[model samples]
Target: MYDYAVIGGGIVGLAAAIAVGKRYPTARIVVLEKEQTWASHQTGNNSGVIHSGIYYKPGSYKAQFCREGNRSMVEFCQQHNIAHEVCGKVIVATEQHELPILENLYQRGLANGLKVNQLSAQQVKEIEPHVQCLAGLRVPSTGIVDYKQVCQKYVEIFQAQAGELRLNTQVQKITSRSDYTVLETNNGTFETRFVINCAGLHSDRIARLTKANPEAKIVPFRGEYYELKPEKRYLVNSLIYPVPNPAFPFLGVHFTRMIDGTVHAGPNAVLSFKREGYHKTDFNLRDLTEVMTYSGFWKLAAKHASEGLQEMVRSYSKTAFVRSLQRLIPEVTEADVIPTHAGVRAQALRPDGQLVDDFLLVSSQNALHVCNAPSPAATSSLEIGKAIASKIPEQSLLASSDCCLVTTNS
Candidate 1:
């Protein structure tokens, strides 16, 4: 039996595996992925922003992990010679009404110990020539890098330590005994002393397989994006963000100049019929049925009906999307952008219609589950890995914690 078996091959899974391998050098560990390649889903499909800790609640996992991760991720990139840029980003407020929200965000950044500066309209123009905003916050610590490459490095590190990785191995069932856990898969069956479930989109299902009742269900919300055509790339010199609505988890449409100098726009959040639905037409009957029947989803839908309708409108109409973009940079037009890609976020929803705001971890005596990790997760991967490694029980020393984060000092 392997000492540890980590499910899912996303960036977080790979990072967690590497940390575990390092912590117990002699332990036999296996990283399993249903897909043939690593980071094929969320990690590869992101905009590559190295998020600052500014957006998260103070003392929460997202804040601490992101702040620490920003440093460690940059160090890793430098040491590994990964292509990256520490280009700063500006969170802009276009209308007078958003000024108060911007101030609150600035204060939140200060509370998180971030080096963020409030900027006047003219000062914002000095940084982003084409942008127009009533006020702005310049976050010099935010950066960008290709996370897929970082996942590659994690795979290498873990494998170098004699860790085994099995591709195309889909876990079909889990039988957790008092002594050990058995992961039955399409390829074969494997027994391990412990399991780490980092299966992003399917995490809830995976938890259920292990007979753990996760309070929240995973619901997929597709983030649709577009890239500015080559000639129009000048509109964005760095990252530009709109002040996010506090009631919602999604940051509004904004511009980001990637490390390679391509500018990506938008990512309006819309509900997807399928868990892995990257296109408008992609659908799965079961995925659709589960979400439609979920009381939490319907509650959330009813609460955000108006904003939800707008997101759906923007998802379909290029004109609606361009209007949102034009709010930040008035020069943007329908001709400037071309549809690029879409990523589905596996958000966890409570029956009360509240989204899990922080990193939610649930554990049994022999297994740990990372149920709801999205957005800044890529940025927080390394620190999160470190924390999980330090916590993975030696011979089930860990106890049962249900539907709550297994807190560790990061």
Candidate 2:
């Protein structure tokens, strides 16, 4: 019998399991992953940008965790000798009409307690000589790191603490007993005192296994990206993001200079047919049906119809994508970039068609389910893990400590 079972071997899952180990050193904690490898999904395919929490709303989990995570993640990389860069990023306004909105973003960054600087077009050029913008907001704390490496270190730490990790162990069902939870998996059946569901794309389904209905459903949005060709890499020195459309949930197309010296650009958000689908043609009938049948998805589609259509057009046409990238860097052309890998984001949408904007944790009987964690999740992972671990009930399971603090209503 294990004290804790963590599903999913992604970065968040590993970090969470590690945190639990630190909290209860004598407890038997196991990390269960469906895939043989770690962080092969969201963590591996992420843009590798460490967010500064400037875009999130003040007093929200994303804001607080992201701000703290930026520092902790950097510290972890530094201590472990991981490859990372604290290269600052600039949010630029290309058109004259976007200047006021840029100012609002600057103010929002300040509200979030970030040391941001409002920049004139000339000042923006001083930082990124190849870019053209009417105004800019420089975020100094933004950085990049390979989360897979970070997960590797987390695995080392957990294993050193005598934690167990079972790869290729996909959870099939969950049964809650009076004292412990029974988890039926492909590998074997296991009984544990508690379960932590960190199954990124499949988190909601895992929650349902315990007979808990998470108010929101996971909808996969594929973020398509392109890398600047070897010859054109010099155009981007660091990250350059456009002022995101407040009406849209996604942070629009942007340029990023990765840690390896190659620059990546244009992660246009488009609906993915499969939760694990990375390519345009990749499809899964069940996944498509769930999305098509979801009223919330249809409502969200209707709400962002225009932007959605544009994203679809750009997905099919390289010229259109290049044109979108040209907004941030006018010099980028069709020949300047090559198609790169894509990462699907599991965004949670409520039945009322409203998107869950914060990191959602739902506490069920003997289980804590991470229902919604997207975008900055990779950046806010360490803090998120600590938060989840801190809320776990004591090993003895007292009458007063029954359920964890569920952030979102179930």
Candidate 3:
């Protein structure tokens, strides 16, 4: 018997378990990971950019968590001796027609309380010499860090508080009793008073298992990237993003300088057939069938058919991907880049063709489910965990009472 059982060993799940353990020191806690290692999904495969809350809407969860997360992440790294860099990023507009949109982005960044400055073409050149832009927004707070390392650190800290980790445990069913819940897993069954469903890819499915009606459905979008050759790494100083297409769910292809001192280019978003699929042909028929059958999926596809088609074209044609990148830096060529790793984003879409923008949480009598956690989630994991820990019913008890008084099987 455990006080809490956390499903999924992604950064968010691990962070949640860590937060819970701190608040409830004597409470038994366990984390279930379907994979052999943690951060094997979104957290491990992301672009590794510590977002500065520039692109998110002001007063929204994304904006709040990102800004707060940026500060906290820097502090956490310093305290734990983690390797990270506060390399700033630039969002540029190459064509004159994009100037107004660029200005709007700058204003939005200002509203979001980010350290943003509008840059002239010459100023942009001063920062990123090889880049071309009509105008741009410089976000100085953006940075990079290996999220996999961050996840590892959390695992260490969580274990210090006596938290247990069970890997390669695939959950099959969940049943809630009057007091506790029973989790049937591939490894063995576990009983716990409370559960946190931080299962990244299969979050919605987990919620349905607990009889909760999650309004949004998970739609996987694969982001394919290319790394710049060693000689051309200077093309980007830090990060170079395009003026996002507001109509689409993804931030358009961008260049990022990773913490490992390598610059990567072009993460073109396309519909992924497999949830964990990194390759172009890594498809799961069941996943594809579920997405194809969802009315919301078709609605979203029809709404952004042009952007969707362009993404597919870029995925198949390297020249097209380079063309998109050339919009920011005219010097980039197909020969200057090579295929890098890819990541699949789990975006939640509604039947009305709306993309769920914020960090969405849905809960039931015995379980709390994180339905949508996208970019900046890795950066915001610690703070997000603290927030989620506060919401659980056991939180108040843990903060004030002794675990010896609460009977697990009562």
Greater TM-score among 1 and 3 belongs to 1
At residue 206, candidate 3 shows an lDDT of 87
lDDT of 1 at 182: 96
Model 1 scores a C-alpha lDDT of 0.91
Candidate number of the best TM-score: 1
Number of the predicted model whose lDDT against the real structure is largest: 1
Instruction: lDDT winner between 1 and 2, please give it.
Output: 1
Residue pairs whose backbone atoms clash in candidate 1: none
Report the lDDT tens digits of candidate 1 across residue range 227-346. Answer: 999999988999999999887779999898888889999899999999999999999999999999999998999888888999999999999999999999999999999999899888
Q: Which ten residues in a row have the lowest lDDT in candidate 3?
A: 401-410
Question: Ranking by lDDT, best first?
Answer: 1, 2, 3
Compute each candidate's TM-score over C-alphas. 0.97, 0.97, 0.95
Q: How many backbone clashes does candidate 2 have?
A: 0
In the range 1-410, model 2's lDDT, one tens digit per residue, is 99999999988899898888888788899999999899989999999999999989898889999999999999999999999999999999988788888888988899999999988999999999988888899999999888888889999998999999899999998888887999999999999999899999999999988877788899999999999999999898889999999899889999998888988997998999999999999999999999999999999999999999999999999999999999988989998899998999989899888999998888777788888888798888889899888888675342222232353314
Clashing pairs in 2: none
